[model samples]
Target: MYTSQQPAIAVDGQNRIHIVWSSYLPIGNALYNIFYRMRNSNGLWGPIETLSVFPNSYHNYNPRVAIDSEGNVHVVWEAYLANEYYPHIAHRVKTNRGWSEVVVLQSSYRRENPSCAVDKFNNLQVVVTTNEIGPSYDIVRFVRTPEGNWEGPDTVVHFNTGSRYFPEIVATPDGNLHLFRRDFGHYTNYCYRIYYKRYKILNYVILE
Candidate 1:
């Protein structure tokens, strides 16, 4: 029996379906970690694989995955830091060899609700919500360069009155990035509207 939480999916160049999700253990320290599995295009499901290597007592959830042009899998998830209350973004890559160690991506404040995509150039892009300034959460982005290095905590969108959450991204062949998020003005308001924006992939610089 397979049970999981916060499941995400992506497709590789070979059309193999890849999935990542969180799973909790019943015994010992009551630990939770991210698990990964894939289904071949030929109609076969592979073995289950645990991605996160965090120690016991920590939780890893809200996973998102993007498969690059080279068939390498990039995954990002949110987890509470040890001895800390705030949540941090964790990332890992699944190469030909196997899943790499989970790496914490730096941010000015705690991050929550993350999404990711791979551009035509095979560069990985991620978006998340952070309450860096005050009670309001802003949409921020992280990008991976051609050299396999990461850059930015770039501000994708910001609002003075409300908090932003649950960001998603999509990259097009023409080098365009489309970002979407949920905004809230106050706790009393549901908003119920989807906020959206589009920008050039090379530079997220606002036209203003």
Candidate 2:
């Protein structure tokens, strides 16, 4: 009845487990849908809830999620619109009320490999890579402020032509941000290496 992949998990302050994954073949369509399930603090597992609200047609892929201090679950993924030429970052959140509607964070850029982290103050950071029609070998980052406005489309890193990929980020209790990503020689016989970078917020700027 269902097939799934790209599972992502996070645990909130209450130790409740949240799981998000992508599945396909709901009714013979070749596209995929993102689903979520959760085990509450009381140890009860909820039913499978579909996250991708494409209603008619679309493909949501490569999901990643993180939990904030308030036990809010935030998820980011790439949704390939039915007739659009590129994919964009899709986001959703689950609070005490319920899951919010899937929001398209960016549709102009062809982004993928979405990852997210929440700071001590619950500022959400989402990092993604552009694989088409963007800078060569670059990673882009977006931060949602505490007041609920999205702050950036920052090109956090660049390695020149097909080397930047798989960016993952996390925020510490002290508000410092850490990122890890892989760089491969996109056009040569070279080594694929994983690297880390640290950034701190100082006077309204991210000092790397």
Candidate 3:
């Protein structure tokens, strides 16, 4: 069982379970790292693996996981790159050999609260909030095509002139996408609502 402020879990067809979480360890002052654990089909959990061992002063959080049809595990999280003021999205994959190298998805944006899902075609869809510019926020999506290529500079899912945060996304059984986010209205000071929207991807067309 993994415990942290942010946690994510995914299961494969073989009943192999994977979990990722953020843990803060005090080296000199305080620092955090993303640790991972897995449960085999026999119900035995492997030892915790330190996925990121950054410096003791940096902060790491908001870990998410997704598993594809071939049983490859993908993980994404928010972390501060060396000599950077803002956090960026970092990704990794698990294979029969071992965990692959950490890949940085977005370097310029202050990204956080990332969640990922794999489509039926084994394409990876990731959604996260960014605060690279001003007070408002934007939701960005990255799709890894089945051809083993990462598509685009990240499509904008939602953009708000007002404040927005905490996005959750899921791929539906019907090949559609569902997204939920916290919305803060501008005029109605007393009205804060959570909004839900559905997106359909048919013939490679993303329809709202």
Candidate 4:
């Protein structure tokens, strides 16, 4: 039975499709752990793998997956770690042997609702919301370089310090990153407002 919801699928250059989602398994009196799954080339799905290993019971949701040119799988989601809530971004590369271990890309502050994509150079770019410090809101980006290392800390996209949620990232064919987010300020009377920004990878400028 499928326990996890919000499944996102992506295919790499070699026609390798990667599927990722968050699953909750009952432990005892209302306890569950978020798990992930994948389908290999032979059209057979591997066993369900647990993503979070927290002791205390916590909820994990909103999982998104993206694959790079080299068949590296990037997964991002909202997970409850310890006593805090934050967005977690992880990557697994397909090697000649098997799938590598999941590597965390971001693990600081209270980030939620993450989205990711890979640029033309096969670099992974992730976007998420953070509200750990104060009442302000911010969108952060994490890029995985070709050297198999994550680029420093998160780079802020917008510094509104307002309410931002439901972020979506997509790398355009022109090598530019397109980010879509919800701005609550514009829709004070309503629920939320949709905001779009195009970021140039080379220049690192957000365009209109």
Q: Give lDDT tens digits, candidate 1, residues 120-192.
A: 7788888888887565778888887656688878788876777788999998888888888877776427665
Ranking by TM-score: 1, 2, 3, 4
lDDT of 1: 0.78
Judged by lDDT against the true structure, how good is candidate 2? 0.78
Q: Whole-model Cα lDDT per candidate?
A: 0.78, 0.78, 0.74, 0.65
Per-prediction TM-score, please? 0.88, 0.88, 0.85, 0.76
- Residue range 1-208, candidate 2, lDDT tens digits: 6678999998887778989998884532327888889898899999988778753437888888898777778888888877676778888888889987777865565788988998766788888888543555578788776555787777788755657788989888786889999887754456788879998954235787
Residue 43 of model 2: what lDDT? 93
Which residue pairs in model 4 clash with each other?
A: 87-111, 137-161
Candidate 1 pairs with clashing backbones: none
Candidate 4 worst ten-residue window by lDDT:
26-35
List candidate 3 segments past 4 Å from native: 1-3, 26-30, 54-57, 132-135, 146-148, 187-190, 203-205
Model 4 per-residue lDDT tens digits across residues 1-208: 6465677888767665667666666543223354567776778877876655444336666777777666656666665544545645445555456665656554566677778887877786777777653466767776766677777445555544457777899997798888888877644555677888777777333344
Model 2 alpha-carbon miss at residue 56, Å = 6.1
| lDDT of each residue in 11-89, candidate 3, tens digit only | 8899889999888753333367788999999999999887765342366788989888788888888877655788777
- Between 1 and 3, whose TM-score is larger? 1
